[model samples]
Target: MKHTVQRDWRVTRPSRKSRFNFDQTTALGGLTVALFTYIIYHFIYPLISKGLLW
Candidate 1:
């Protein structure tokens, strides 16, 4: 008597194609916006409020 093994196709399919990385893109965009806002509020706003930046 002999035995054989079977494999499932679904387990290996994702390796062939990359899934859309929307999560990463969104997180990066949010971080960039936060950084820009922080810079404007902390550095630029202070200068403007003091009537030094023009």
Candidate 2:
């Protein structure tokens, strides 16, 4: 006896524009980096430092 399974697949279509708007992407990336840095310094850095020392 043979059994067959059914599956559904989905594909995402790409945008037609070949060139990216770098200015917006770069600005958003910079903001994200700044926010991540602030959080790490405020919360994570102290914990890591204490772990390393003791």
lDDT values of the candidates?
A: 0.85, 0.80
TM-score of 1: 0.59
Clashes of 2: 0
Model 2 per-residue lDDT tens digits across residues 1-54: 778775645446754665765578899999999999999998889989889635
Error of 1 at 34 (Å): 0.3
Task: Point out the worst 10-residue segment of candidate 1 by lDDT.
Answer: 9-18
Please estimate how well model 2 matches the true structure, expressed as its whole-model Cα lDDT.
Answer: 0.80
Measured against the true structure, the TM-scores of the candidates, in listed sequence, are 0.59, 0.47
Against the true structure, whose TM-score is highest? 1
Error of 2 at 25 (Å): 0.7
